[model samples]
Target chain A: MPVPDDRKQQPKTTADAKIPGAYEGETVTRRRFMTASAHTAGGIATAAFTLPALGMAFGPVFEKEQVRWEAVGPTEDFPDDTYIPRTITLSPGIGEVGKSTVYVRRYNDTIDSEVKDEYNDYVAITSRCMHLGCPVRYVEASERFICPCHGGVYDREGKVSGGPPVRPLDRFYTRVRDGIVEVGPRYSLNSELRRFSPRDPGQAIDGVGQYLYPSRPSIRKLPGT
Target chain B: MAKLPTTSGTRPRGTRAETTEAPATAPQRNKLQETGVSTIDWLDERTSLSAGARWMMFRKIPKGTNWFYTLGSATMFAFLSQAVTGVFLAMYYDPSATRAYESVRFLTNEVFLGEFVRGMHKWGSTVMVILIFLHMARTFFFGAYKYPRELNWVIGVVLLILTLAMSFTGYLLPFDQRSYWATTVGVAINGTGPLVGPYLSDFLRAGPEFGATTLARFYAIHMLLLPGIIAAMIGAHLYLVARLGTTAPPWIRAESSPELREDSK
Candidate 1:
C-alpha cells in the first residue's frame, strides 16, 4: 500500500536522533533502527540462554553402563562378629573408581533345613546415609546407626528410624567361593539373584570346623561356695 | 530581495509594499545584573555524569569496599576453583564398583597436582559452605534482609539449601565407606516420607537400591546438575544486591546533634 502524500511528506528522524540531518527525499528514524537492532540482539540472547541448559540436561543420557566392585573381605576369617571399619578399593568403570568398607555381622543362629545352599553364612551392610550425605556412626548402646550431622537414626536392620535420611542402608553382595569370602556390588531384595541362598544347619559343620574358646566354659563356671 | 507577496490570488495592482513594521515595539528585557545565576544554569547544562552512577555501573571499585565483600566473592571463586578441580577429577572418577576406587587412587597419586588440587577442591568446598553460611548470617544481622531486600533473603535461603545439597551429593562421589553408608541413611530417610517414599528412594538410586546406577546418578548430579542451579541462584542474588543498593551505615540516620540540624537548617 502506498502512503498518502501528506503523511509521506513528514520529515523522519535519522539513526542518530540528537542531530538532524538534511535529506532531500526520504529519511530513516532512530527508533526504527533501534527496534531492528534490539530484535536481533534479543534473538541472539535467547539462543545463548537456552543452549547451555539443553546441553547439560541431555548430554549424559546415552552414557555407557558401568558396574563393578572391590573385594571387601574373605569369608571364614571375618568371624561371627561385627565387621569393623575398613576401606575396600575398586574400579567401577574404565576410569571410574571408589572406596567403600563392608560392615558384616554374624551371630549364632540355627539355619533352616529347607533353604540350604552352598554360598556363605553372613550378611553385610554399607553405612552410607541416603540423605545429604553424612557419616553414620553405629551406636552400640542404642544398637542403631546415627548420623551426627542431621541426627538421622537407623534401626539395627539399617531401616530408617528418624531424621532426614531418605532410604534404608545399602547391603553388599556376599558369597563363599572355596573358603574365601568376597562381596560384589551392593545388592537389594529385588536383584536378579533373588535372596541369598540359605545356609545349612549349624550341626552340618561337623565339629572339625568349630573353634572352642577357653572363655566360654570358664565364664559359665563361676566360683561356687 | 524579492518583494513579499500579500496573496497570490489577490495582490494590489500598483505600488511597492510599505514598511509599517509596527515601529519595532521597544524590547522588554531584564538587565538586573543577571544575579550571577549563570553559574547554576551553566552547571546544570554541563550534564556531567553523577559519580555514584558512574562508579556503580562502571569504574574500578576501591580496595576498601572490595575487602569484606571478597568473602562472598571468594566463596564464588572457590566454587569455580572446585569446578576446575572437579573437572580434573571427573576425568579420572569412576562411578561404579570396579573402577571407582582405582580411579580415586589415580587421581590421588598419578595425576599431576591431582592430590593437591583435589585436596584444595575438597577443602574449598568446606570453606565455601562455611563462607556462604557466614554471608547469610552477616546479611541477617545487618538487617540487609529487611524491607525491599526480602527476595534476596529468600534466594539466599534457596542457595543455602543448594549448597548443602551440593555437599551431600559431592560426598557420595568418592564412593568411600563413609559415603556409601551416609548415602544409605540418606536413602532410608527419603523412604520414610508419606506416599512416594519407596518410589523416591528407588528413583534416587535409579533402582530398587543403591548400585552402579546410584553412583552414576549422584556423580552426574553433583558434578553437572546442582552446580548449574547454584550458578543461577548466585547470578540472581548478585543482580538483586546491585539493584537494591547496599545497606547504609546506621549512624547516617541517627541524627542526634542539634548543631547538625541547625547547620542543615
Candidate 2:
C-alpha cells in the first residue's frame, strides 16, 4: 500500500486514539449502537428524574416577596391604646397560608417617642416568643406576654421584661391605609437594636444586648451567670 | 453451513426448530447489523465510554479475594437504596413543625406506595449503618487499612460519621413525640460539651430549644448537607480503592512476608 499522508503524525493521547477503531470506518455493531443510544437515553431520563426534585427542594429560594401589608380590617376593629389579640390568616408566600395570632395595639400617643411616623399609629406583636418558639399568651391584666414553655415575659411594648427570653417579643410589620390596618411579616428586634451596647443591661432594649443574656432569674443560665 | 451437534432427545416439547435456524431475510439482518455497528462507531467517536467501561470491569484483581470482599460493595448498594427511597419519601414530608406529622400520616395512609418507600428509606438507613459497620470490621480484620490504603480508611471513617449524622437528622423530620423528645435530648447532650458545646447545640437547634427552626435546620442537614458530604467522601474512597486495588487477606500477607518466613525458618 502507498504511504499515507501524515504517516509520521505526532502521537495522540486523546480517548479517540486509545479506543480501537474509534475513528475508523464501520466501527459500530448493531448491539453496540443500541447500547450507546440506550446509555444516552438513560442519562436523559436520570436528569429528568433529578432536575425537578432539585428544583422543588430549592423552590422556596425563588419564591416571591413574602412580607406584604395584608389588611386586617378597619381601624375601628382595633380600638385606641387597647391590646386586641386577633387571629389573622396570612399568606406569607406561595403555598404557605396559615393563621397567626397577633396582639394589635393602637396608641394615639407614640409608644416609642424616638421614632415618629406610622409606627406610632399601631403595633402588631406576634405571639411567637423570642426565646424558644412557644406561642406567648397576652396577659392583659399584667400588661405583659408570658411564654408557657420558658416563662418568658414581654411588656406591652414587646420589650423583654422577665423570664428566659434573651430578647424582646418579635413584632409584625404594620401599616394604616385608607382607615384600615394591615400587618406584614414578623421580624426580630435584634436588627433594630443592633447598635446598642452589649455590656450595659439598661441599654439591652436599645442595643441587641438583650439577645446576649438569658432573661433575669433565668433557670437556664450557665453556672457563672 | 455444517449443522452443530444437538441432544435431540432432550429437546423440550413444542419448541420451534426455527429458533436455531438462521434469519429468513439475510439482507435485512445484514442491514440491521450494519446500522447497529455504525451507531456504536458514531458514539465511540464522541465518547470513549466503552474503553473506560472495559478498563473498570476487567481490571486485574488479586486472586483469593473471595465473597468476603463483597461487604463493601453491599454497603454501597445499601447506601444507594437509602438515597433513592429517601428521595421518594421527601416528596410528601413537610419540614414544618405543625404540618410535618400530618404530612407523614398522609404519606403513610393516603399516598400510593408512600408507605413502601418510607419503609425502604427507614430500613435502608438501618441496613446501611449495619453494612458499613460490618464492612469496617471486615476491613480491619483483613488489615486492609495498611500502607497506601490509609487515606481510604480515613475517608471511610468520615463517611461513617456523615452517615450517622444523616440518620440523626432524619430522625427528627417525622415530627412525632418520640422524635421531638429524642432530638431535644440529643441537642442537650451536645450542649454538655465543653466550650463550643453550647454554641454548637444552639446552632443545631437554630435557637435555645427545639421547635420549628430546629425541624427546618435538621431537615436541611439530613436532606442536603450530609448527603453531599457523604457522596464526595464515597467518591474519594472508591477512587482510592480502585487505585490501590483491594488489599489481600491477612493470611496471604503473612504467607508473602519475607520476615515471617525468616522467623519460621
Model 1, B1-265: lDDT tens per residue? Answer: 1222332235464343353233334422222222233333344334533443444576443223434455667778878888888888887787775667678888899889889988988898999899888777667766768999999899989988988888888887776767776776677566444444444555566544344567777888888788899889888987787777666433235435666565544
**lDDT tens digits by residue: candidate 2, A1-225:** 987697666445333345554554444545578999999999999999899976654443233323356787788888765688877754332122245688887764545422444443677777766554556898878878988766888777777788866566656657788988888655445534321211111113434344443232101211221
Interface RMSD, model 1, angstroms: 17.2
**How high is the lDDT of residue A128 in model 2?**
65
lDDT of each: 0.58, 0.67
Show model 2 residue runs off by greater than 4 Å.
Answer: A1-225, B1-40, B253-265
For residues B109-186, what per-residue lDDT tens digits would candidate 2 score against the true structure? 999998888998888889899999999999999889999889899999988888888888988888776786567556
* Residue A67 Cα positional deviation in candidate 2, in Å, after optimal superposition: 24
What candidate 1 gets wrong by more than 4 Å, as runs, is: A1-225, B1-69, B249-265
Worst 10 residues of 1 chain A by lDDT: A197-206
TM-score of 2: 0.50
